[model samples]
Target: MKIWYCFTPLITYVADTPEELIIACATMNSLPVTIATCGDFGDPIQHPPCDGSSTLANITAIITSILPSDLIVFFKACKHYNLNGVNLPFWRNWFAANPSSFLIPELLHHLHKMFWDHDHLWCTTVVGSQEIDFRFVLLQVWTDHHNVQWYIIGVIAGAAPTDFISAIRALMEFKYLTEAPHFTKKQVVHLDCCLKVFHWLKQSIVDTGAWWGKGGGDKPWAIPKLELLQGVVPSIYSHGTVMQWSTDPTEHVHIRVVKEPSRAGNNHNYDAQVCRHLDRRDKVECFDLILQIYDPTLMKMTVDKAAGNFSLPDLCPAVSDHLN
Candidate 1:
């Protein structure tokens, strides 16, 4: 995955200084990975924002300038305007197909005290067994390309909630989470298969408890999460837990890997990038587990069905720079 990060030093309120860069990083805490502050800034820097605040509106312009971004980050300056943070609703969604129309102010006020109530909404059923939950979605959506197929070979697993996905959607569609008392059908919120699928697949395993350190001796610290990753275990095996939904390998022996296939098709480079995220940032890591079970070349993931209690991550905005 190729991600481009851009920031106008002015956004951070400090230009050409370490303080400015640090502030910019602090502004972009909503997404994983570091920022490559280009256009005005040189080289990609590991930017983890300090406080939860973000310059979202100003950053939107920079993100829009770079079209076709796998992901985008921003910093907002509501403080400069003396307004509380931009009151982006908790349930608004990032409508990639229609970004501009995602939010409306009157709608925000209406959503202020009620649960989401969209009068105009449509829902689609992901055709699969009720037993299959969020984990299967990752194994299924691994390769975005049409040519590469996916398969689940080794052992079968069970369903688990991907908190990362839940967090992102909650933020994007907060306004649409409930109906605007003043207007009906003027704003609509619904599940989107394509956008939510990709968004969550890249973001699901982030900051989850399942992702622990590899034993650094003292306090076990988690690694940074990456936008892309792929892998094969150094080697392993175990003999425990016989359920179908667990990624946990209780049998003492297991293979854990996350690889990112470059557009250039260099698997080795992809592996290095994965390591950097897992080793450096201390963020949670997500790998497509099905590959260890099935062959990548033979069959492809044809029908991904999410039965019950399952939905796409972007259905609601989950992450925000509102907190530190």
Candidate 2:
């Protein structure tokens, strides 16, 4: 059986220490893990250049050590924290330099024209605020799946090219692994497009100085290291496909199902809230299963009778004729 693992902000709270986190991961079956940030991990500065904490480094090393080498791990960069380090400053400067041009209609128009001509892929833009008052761009990448219709797998904010390029590269790599044909001419064509776009974006970032630009700081600096971005290509090449391995679906469950009810009851008691959410979900699932197994036609007839429309002919003359 295939399983998908996700390390999100909420779940990370279950483990207090790195060792505990490793234990929690061990409990899960072999699966592709999508790693995101958590408050428990503390600040990035605590672990890296600033000090030798190695909280994240240790957690990830443990995860990789236990999981198979081919196991796909998706590193979702947090926009709030600037996972790449360069995002905040680069975008701050980009907005300042451009002035009224960041995420404006003109920029969006150009982006849409350049990227959305193909039917399979498209983008959506929303106006968002950052740092409380400053405005930022929220761009979402969506794909038209032959089975699932439209699904958004990536969301990138700010005007920095590195952020955009990185997000786009991940999305395209995912598409190549999940959507492309296998061992066929179509596969080659699809992969060519993916590589072409990937290279183009990387080159654009370098050429435009977006990779190494001065913004919200003293001097121009090199792009911040994003360890998550490093594994994407290799994982795709090793694992045949990354389909259904993303955290988007789990995220949707949290946002649409868990958070609201938890808040409505008692937001303060984290453990109780989680327990209640799980209980409610299980009950709901069982009810749905019961409905699925039960005959629907009987329910329809009962409803019709209760509404004083008991005549079968009134409901469906064809059914009445067949009965006669």
Q: Pick the candidate with the highest TM-score.
A: 2
What TM-score do all the candidates reach, one by one?
0.15, 0.31
Task: Give candidate 2 regions above 4 Å deviation.
Answer: 1-178, 181-186, 189-203, 206-238, 244-249, 252-257, 277-324
Q: After superposition, how far is residue 207 of candidate 2 from its true place, in Å?
A: 5.0
* Candidate 1: residue 194 Cα off by (Å): 20
Q: Give lDDT tens digits, candidate 2, residues 76-103.
A: 2212221221112222222222111111
lDDT of 2: 0.33
TM-score between candidate 1 and the true structure: 0.15
* Model 1: ten consecutive residues of lowest lDDT: 228-237
Clashes of each: 70, 0
65 Cα displacement, candidate 1 (Å): 45
Candidate 1 lDDT, 1-324, residue by residue in tens: 999875322111111122222333322222211222222111112233222223444334345643323232222343232222333422124222111111111212122211111111100011123323343464665533221111211011222344433432342243233222322232221312222342444233323343223452332222212110100000001111111112234212222234221332345667676666556434322222332244443123233455323222332233211110
lDDT of 2 at 278: 77
